[model samples]
Target chain A: MPRQVRLRRHPVGALAADDFHVVDVPMPEPRDGEVLVRNTWTSVDPAIRIRLAAVAPAGYFPAFGLDAPMDGIMAVGEVVESLAVGFESGDTVWHTYGWRDYAAVPAGAGALGALGSLRRLDTAVAPAHAYLGPLGPMGLTAYAGLFDVAELCAGDVVWVSAAAGAVGSLAAQFAKLRGHTVIGSAGSDDKVAFVLGELGLDAAFNYKRGAIEDQLRAAAPDGIDVYFDNVGGDHLRAALSVLRRWGRVAICGAVSQYERDRPAPGPDNLFQAVANDLTLRGFRGSSYTDRMDDMQRDVAAWLRAGVLRHRETVVEGLEQAPEALVRMLAGGTIGKTLVHIA
Target chain B: MPRQVRLRRHPVGALAADDFHVVDVPMPEPRDGEVLVRNTWTSVDPAIRIRLAAVAPAGYFPAFGLDAPMDGIMAVGEVVESLAVGFESGDTVWHTYGWRDYAAVPAGAGALGALGSLRRLDTAVAPAHAYLGPLGPMGLTAYAGLFDVAELCAGDVVWVSAAAGAVGSLAAQFAKLRGHTVIGSAGSDDKVAFVLGELGLDAAFNYKRGAIEDQLRAAAPDGIDVYFDNVGGDHLRAALSVLRRWGRVAICGAVSQYERDRPAPGPDNLFQAVANDLTLRGFRGSSYTDRMDDMQRDVAAWLRAGVLRHRETVVEGLEQAPEALVRMLAGGTIGKTLVHIA
Candidate 1:
């Protein structure tokens, strides 16, 4: 028997542990061309809250059905049984089936636009769990957002919202490493210290203190050239006001809106895009699978060189995955949040 | 004395005649490096509503002061005196000083980012009034928005909101002429008829007739690739829902938000941009003056070959400029709305 988490009910407002239930289920068999994975480390991303809605936003991942196994989450594990070619019984791997102990997944199929395709993990480059963070989707997200979507120009002034979170920390560091002026904004003063002291951003602010727009204006007196948006709503509004002419906003996620009982209307000042010749581009890490190799190569090299840093708030068991997600969404955890369920 | 239409007070809700007053002022004399012109035709654009606000959206043309000459409007006239270089008396010209019978304008000064700068017009290509419609700012707006901002790709199904109006009509026609399937959405059935019949768009819809989203889906059964957003709000919401993967939105203007008593929140489904890899880029025609020569060259040729069709909604005098704007904003008129002021 294997343990798994199921959606007990859709979250009404802030996600609570009561919204999910842990269940003991019989092991699933690997079909032809499928591999059985014993999930060891599963991701707890703020983006998952979007799927917990009754009906997910249009063009997003489908909503999680009531009393069903949660899927489409990133996980790293060991291949237990292989009916698929090129997969060995003992190889470490990553896939898009998580919040469960074991999964029977087809090798060639892609989840989240090939970002979560079943692939063998080169643990030589990084640890198995690293595939769930710095060397994996988060890394690709930060990389593609800065270099690909925002098109980071030389001498650009960059700002990362939720700067101590999974994707934000990496994006801020990448810009800093590239010798650009980088500012970070986080929910707590502790996270702001982490951004300034650990991640080494040029300026870091605690967004919980005062008016976001005023704080951003104070941090960047002149204005920002690029905004990596992880918190939508008021955060986006502030960015719109502080962004200079021809500014670019890479809309990675809207964590602030995800936990709300109802969807918040988008920023009122989106008209600023026209006023300042700005571009507000929304993107997902999964959308940029083509950049994964470059991201892994550079990020892994940085990690080995002690130039790139990663943090993970780990939970004890599969049953606590729901609690882990709630913690992550509330900004209670810094950097990546994960569940360890051998 | 030269008569000018000056702002009496900023409009509330909908623009009324009382918001503007016609005043007879002392005739302006050309200063050094200036041209004094007797204005002939002036433009009444939906975008002008933005400047009437207490503070216009940032990076936009500054808000018009109470009881001041409404600057930044496009007008064509004949130069009565040329104290500026390269300008001879009796030469036809265009400048930003509109809502007036006479203007003394500097030669090299720019307004609205140089889009409204004083420039001599080649009247032989088209009449002076045509410059205000198909050959002037409207044309540049349509061209720059489609080609530069949206980056229209081949086989792109295009949607233009406010499709029978000044900039919309030209954008729709340009896409149609370029052999792409174009859909036009207007407020009234007659305007829909104008879009389908006169503009030759592939599909046309009356947005007021049904749910905007459903109407857009019905018009573009297969999702649209490019959206020229002249009307922002529910119209933008409809576009976000119906736009396909990798779709693009050129935010040329947000007329729907301009006249509101207070600002409106942007579309709720802007997260669709991340889900579908969409890009929303805002721009003004003046932002791309370098494209002017190309636009004039192509548009002038089309006008000569009898392929490019244009219609003008003419108000009798400068005194009616406010009324013209009111009519245009209310969707009471089609194509270009102009005031014939001598």
Candidate 2:
């Protein structure tokens, strides 16, 4: 019997515990291009909330049917019975299966084989959970934003919002490695200190302390050339004020106002895009999947060479997934929030 | 002592005739490394109004001083005297020496020479006003926005705002040439009729008559792939609502709200960028000035061969420059508005 978490009802505002329910199901055999995966761990992200409500209905995979399994990106067990040629029994892999004890995944699903390069993750570089955090899609979101999207070059000044989050921490390090002067903003003084002292950011500020504009001005005295925007709102408006002419903004996420039912009151400074000839590009790392092999090769090399680092906050159990998400959404969890199923 | 117009004072809101002053002085001769140009025509654009307010203090050129000549893209006469050896007597040219009766332009000051293939204007294909309209920066702005900035391709559907304006009209024709479906919106029914019935636009509407969203939805039923934004504000919000996934918005101009002394309302649908993975790039035609040889070459060729068409609203005399700008800002003029000095 497979125990599955099913979406019993659609969420309107914040998701409640009753939105989902755990149910038992019978296991089924695999098809020609399918493999049965025993679920280990599932990855939860804010984008999941978007999938639950918005987006074109026909374009998205239909919502967890009433009384059916809730689907998501999951780290899975070896293929017990595989019709697909690539897998055999006892092999550990990841697939976008669902909130379930067992699932039948078709060939080529999830973040692809891109997640498996962590098999050789070095303890000296980053813990295993860090791979799922800074070195995973979240980390890559920062990397692509700072380098590929913002095109951060040596001697440029970089400012990152949500500085202690999974993506922001990695982005700071990447900017530092590229010889950029880095600054960050976080919700608490402790996280600010972590970014400044531990991560070696040139400057860090607690956004909760004062006005975001004054904080940003104090952090980036010279001016900001690149901004990795994870928290959009007043923070975005503040960054716009001090941005250098021809500045580049890499918009990875807008977690600051993501939970709102209606659009938040964001900055009125977008006119700077014209006055300063600025480029504000919103990038989705999923679009750059073809470059994953190259990213893994380069990032692994960087990790081994002691040029990069990552951190994670592990919650031990698939059952704790909901709680971890709540903690993450509440801004209580630091670094990458991960589930370690045993 | 070139006769020039100077910014006497910044306008509080609507620009008045007293905002600028024109003075007649003896023309100066070219010195070392300089070329003397007899000013023939000057472009009156919406951007000039932006320059007058000193709002956007930082752009390609320095801001207009409290009391100094406003220099921008201008069409001028040949070097009557040659201190710059490259340009000799009677060589007709165009340069950036605006708000002036005569200018001692430095060598390579908007210097564009004819390419061998381009058919030089001989009062046959169109009027001389075409150079300032479809054959000059306005044409290039449309071309670069459509082909370079947006990377629009054939079969792609384009939704252009301010469709009957100089750049927008050229953009519609250019998109048609590229085999793309083009839709446009203008302020009045006459402009809409001209764009749809005369210019061969796939569809067009008068945005002033009704809600922009309803008009956009009806025009672009399949969704907008490329949106060349000229009129920002509610039009931009409407475009964002109808843009397809991964749509490209070429932020060419925002003439709608340029007159405001205070900043306008924020784009309410900005979150759509994340949802659709859209790329919004704000660009200016001046940055790509090196392409003048190429643009003039192609545009001139197209004009002579009747492969391209354009319109001109000529306001004769340098004194009428302010009136031309006023007309443009009020959206009363179609195609390019030029100040013709006799």
Candidate 3:
């Protein structure tokens, strides 16, 4: 028998472990064109919280039902039984099934068909959990947001909120690699040190310290040209105020308000969009699949060149997945939060 | 002697006649490449309010200093003296100089050099004031905001705020000409009737009658694809709530908040931009100079065919320019507000 986590109730404000219940079930078997995978690493992402609501907002991601086995975005596993043409037994693979001991997946049902195709892991390059962090949607989000959405160019001053988080870390490094000056904001002094000392960002600030506007002004001196917004609310308002004429904002996420019962009011100065000729555009990683192959190649090369770094906080066992998600949502995690369940 | 209106003091909240002073100055002789024009009609535009502040926001239009002659966008007059080629003494000229009885301008300096080159009025199609209303930047703004900014298509459902004003009236007609369903919002029942009966909009509402969200939902039962935003507070929030996936917004103005000592907070559900994949872009008419000739030709043809109607609220005398501006700002005037100074 294998254990799986099922949703017992929809969360209201902040998530609690009781919202999920662990259940024992018979292990799934591979059918025709299917492979049985023993998942090794599972990702805990903030976006999954949107689906935990009773009814997802229209046109957004679908919601989860009570008493049903929950699923999320990324999982790394190994094939134990292969009934598919392209996969072999013991081959490592990444899929979109997680929070369970074993998953029976159809051949090439990659990222649960949301990310197009399933990917095989090359253990020689990095560890299995690395695929769930830097090599997964987090990396792709950073790449797409900076180059495709914000249109970052050399000499541009870039600001990334949630600077020590998975996506923000990569975005900062990528901007710096392209000869652009980058400033970052984190929640604590330790994360600020990680962003400034380890990530080698030009400047880093603790947003919890003082006014975001004052910190941003001190960091950039002039004004930022591109703002990669992950934490919304006051960070967004400060960015709008300090953005130069024709500044561009790539709205990646609003993690600060995701768990709140009601969304905080938007920035008061959005009218600045008309006065300063600024552009604020929102995008998701799913829309940029056309550039994935190129992005993967460049990121892999950068990883090998020591220009990019991958960081993860791993918790043990399947039962801890809910706790991991709650911790990540609480803004205590430095980088990607994952659960190692073998 | 020529009578000119000068700024007495920068306006605080809403404009008042006390903020302006009318004075007479000795008539100036035309220099080389100069022309002396007796102004007949002058435009009172909402955008002029941004410059009346003692210190305009950085990167926006420059501020009007105290005691200096105040100038606005478009003015129609007859050239009384010409010292340049391609001009005659009696040629009807349209320049970007206004709030004055007479103006001495360089023959080639059109619209005070802010509207690109100078344009000579052709009175064969309509009256002289028509050039300042529908045939001028008003029409160009509507044309460009729809086709270029919002990318309105034939089958798209469009919502235009401030629909009885100069730009909004033209925008509604232009969208209809392209076979789109147009809805409009005004501040009064008469203006609502004007939009519904005269402009022939698909739906019209007075924003003061009910909650803007309920009104918008009732009008656009399914959803809206394009929003031409002129009133930016609650109206913008309502539009955001009803915009379909991939909907586009052309932010033309925030008239409701422009006169406030502090701008109102923006739409609370702007996060919907992420879930709905909406695009909100701001633009000024000055950026669309290349489309002016085509717009003029099309508007003239529409005017002659009786497909387009020009409306104006004319206040008489140079001393009344400030009164006209105040009336227009207070939303009491319909269509373009102008002062007849001749």
Q: How many clashing pairs does model 1 include? A: 0
Best model per lDDT = 1
Question: What's every prediction's RMSD, in angstroms?
Answer: 1.4, 4.4, 3.0
What is the DockQ for all candidates, taken in turn? 0.82, 0.35, 0.58
Quickly count the clashes in candidate 2: 0
CAPRI category for model 2:
acceptable
Native-referenced Cα lDDT, model 1: 0.91
Q: Which pairs clash in the backbone of model 2?
A: none
Give TM-scores of the second chain, every candidate.
Answer: 0.98, 0.91, 0.96
Q: Write the per-residue lDDT of candidate 1 for residues A46-86, one digit (tens) a residue.
A: 88999998998878888989888787999999999999999
Give the poorly placed runs of model 2, Cα more than 4 Å off: A1-33, A52-68, A78-84, A109-131, A151-156, A178-180, A211-214, A265-267, B1-8, B16-37, B57-60, B73-91, B108-128
Over B153-248, each residue of candidate 3 has an lDDT whose tens digit, in order, gives 768999999999999999989998888899999999999999999999999999999999899889999999999998888889998889998788
Query: Model 1 — interface RMS deviation?
Result: 1.0
Locate the minimum summed-lDDT window of 10 residues in model 1 chain A: A255-264
Docking quality (DockQ) of candidate 1:
0.82
As a whole number from 0 to 100, the lDDT of residue A165 in candidate 3 is: 91
The DockQ-derived docking category for candidate 1 is high
- Which candidate, 2 or 3, would have the higher lDDT against the true structure? 3
| Cα lDDT tens digits for candidate 2, A266-305 | 4666666666667777767665556555666667777778
